[model samples]
Target chain A: MKLVRIFFKAVTMELSRRMAYKADFIIRCFILVINSIISPIFALILYTTTPGIPGWKFEEFILFQGTLIFVFGFTHAFFWQLLSFTIYEVRKGSFDRFLLLPYKPLSYLTASSIETDGFSEMFTGIIIIWWAFKKLGLSIFSANFILYIYLVFLALVFHYSLNIITASFSLIFIRSWALMDILSSLVIFAKYPASIYHIGMVFFFTFIFPIAISAHYPVQALLSAVSYKLILFLTLSVSLFFYLSISLWNFGLKKYKSAGG
Target chain B: MKKYRELTKIGAKIALAYKFDFIVSIFTVPISIIVFYFLWKTIYAYSGLDVIRGYTFEEMVNYFIMSMVIALLGWSNIERVVEYDVLYGEMVLRLLSPVTYLASLFYTEMGLKAMSLLVEATPIFLIGIVFFKAKVFSILNLILYAIAVLFSIGLVFLISFLIGLSSFWLKRISGISRSKKLFLSFLGGGFVPLTFFPKIFQQISEWLPFQYIRYVPINIYLGKYSTFLALEMIGRQIIWIILLYIIAKILWNRAIRKFCGVGV
Candidate 1:
């Protein structure tokens, strides 16, 4: 409860600081929206030129993309800064400040920073999802909707795990931003439907990295019923992944050395 | 010219000191290309077409591979550095320097590109040609492509310089710079072939300078244009460079006056 209050306070301060520059803030949001839509627009071009990835119409594929944007936006809003802040502070020898705070470093860092631009991405995603849902004539009030919500929760947990893993690298490598870039590049695979790739790739993405769970499963739930066995597998695997990530963070903490600013 | 040469050497050294970043690109670039390959390969296979919008599957793959090469050769981050400089008052020291700021920047970028060409771009170019069997152009066409690329480098630099110059007025240029990058990648045919775009988009792109940045040079390499047309496009690139240079000069003059007025 105390952590939640501190997080909200920090977010409020961050929001107020950003809101001070009205034009800059607005333009930043607009740019983020543009960034979010570029992939869909490219997909539009692909679908126009040729039949897109088999077994998926443009609208359905768009729902997949929209779900991806939403998941990524959510992760970006809450956890993206933790990676950068850890790296920058560690490199500058200022991370001791965080350690001196009367709270756990991980919890305090995660709660204090929020990426306001991510809200624009999330807003754009909701619009795209709504548009696709309308076109597909899908009803919202179904059992699958509840399942979709649960899967999205799972997806967020998965993303938070990934963020923590990267943050752990920052503590050790001190210049692990490229690792984040590589991860983002790899995540591009999840933007497409799983049916298009070879079975090997699908398996690798699911069991190994589990990036597919971020968007693919939630969209799958919306479009059709997801199997219980798959859900059970996802729940267990993601929990294990989260556990591993935390272990990595603790290991990184042990390895941490002050730069002595 | 001597000072500019020294600045270029400094830039090369700086890029050399950041060898890890070059290694990162070595991995990131091919990963992007691989993703494009799989996506397009699946599209072609499912559509049951040998060619879409005048590009065979091989040609399409070659196009993206070449896009990566051209992207590396033409890449510039001067705008970001400039924005940081202006915001942090580092521009004051730069303004006091004897060499011209913009020319210094151009030379520095040239040095960095020269290093990238040696360390990164050469290997990718060789791989695309040898492994991917990218199109082999005639000597005359290769010369024309080089000329087009030189102009492209100039055009990209001037555009970025102009954006950086805006830092004099705007407190932050991240939004503007990112928006520019998004448009450049999309309309410049970095993302997809302009031929695949709708007729209206193609027409609009034709009137803008964006396509010349990536599309025209690659198309020339692919022999999509006759010799005469390729020359014409290079001519247009030079025209755009001249126009942008003039705009940059005017902006710089005004920006300098503003800086002097503010006594920074």
Candidate 2:
């Protein structure tokens, strides 16, 4: 409970700081909202031309896209600043200040900066998801729905783990920014159905990089096409990736030669 | 003319210093191209049609390869310029430069993009020839296409410069820059051919400068347009370039005035 309170307090303080730049905050949120809307407009255009994409119907595709957006929105809203923290802190040699503190450095780094503007994307995602469900006539209270939600939570873990691993590269490389850009583009690939790729490509995304688990697994679970074996595989993969990322992060930290002033 | 030559030469030399980044960008191109290849292949497989929107599977692949090259060559990292200038107040020096700041920046970007394109596009083009059995163009056609590509770069540079200039008024312009990039990709037929869009949207997109940056040039390269038609398209690009250049100039002037008044 104490830890929870401290986390909330940190988030509140970051939010207040962001709110101080009220005009910028509001404009940023508006831009994000418009950006989110544009994706659906494209999807609508596609639906109009074709009855549905192969394997997945138009509504289901919308659901998949919405879920991916929702995950992105949630992650970016809460942890967007985490993406730049390592680079900025390492470059400024201000990371030592965190090292001087008693609490976990990673936790403090994560809580240092929060972008409230990202909340607009999160809100837009929720609306999109709701629209998809309503259009598909899917019952939100069903057992399958619960499973889908669980899978999405797991996918979020996989996504966050990948980002954390990429961001930790800042400890060694000054130009680690491109790594994040590459990873983000890789994540955008997941916005589409994964069955589109060959089985070999699926294996590559699942075992090699784990981009498949980011969206494909959750959408598969929701569609009820994914077997229990696959679900178990995906869950274990998420855990393994997170474990690997944490280990890699710690290893990279030791390699850090604090940027010379 | 002498000044332009000197500027271009200087720009080319500075870009050559970043050999590591140039090499890294080469690898990134294949990742996106591979993704799009499989994506379109899957779509075609599901449709059970060999052609869509007047493009065969072979032609679509060719179009995308061309689009990838065009996009890479024309892409502007103007947001970095904006962030650096705004945060460090280095834009003051830029304003003081006697030559047009936009021209100097565009020249530097063009040099860097040209080098990166050569490094990246050579491999992709080779693979494309092997896989798609791509056809060769005549010398005249190649020359015309090169001119189109340069104009496309000029058009993209202007658009990106305008977006960066907006940072003078808006605090966080990265999102705006991102959206503009995505918008161009969509409207410019970088993702899929603009012909696939509905008639109304397709017509609307034609008037937009985005199509001139990627779609028209690739189409000309693929022999999709006649000699006269290609010339007409290039003519249109020149007009858009002039229009955007005027807008960017006006915006820069206003932004500088605002900055001076506010003492930023």
Candidate achieving the largest TM-score: 1
Candidate 2 iRMSD in angstroms: 2.5
Q: What fraction of the real A-B contacts shows up in model 2?
A: 0.30
What residue runs in model 2 are displaced by over 4 Å at the alpha carbon?
A1-6, A9-21, A259-261, B1-6, B13-18, B79-89, B121-124, B127-140, B168-172, B251-263
Each candidate's lDDT (Cα)?
0.84, 0.75
Off by over 4 Å in 1: B127-143, B261-264
* Angstrom error at residue B10, model 1: 1.1
Clashes of 2: 0
Chain A only: TM-score of every candidate? Answer: 0.94, 0.92
Tens digits of per-residue lDDT for model 1, B15-41: 898777776777777767767777888
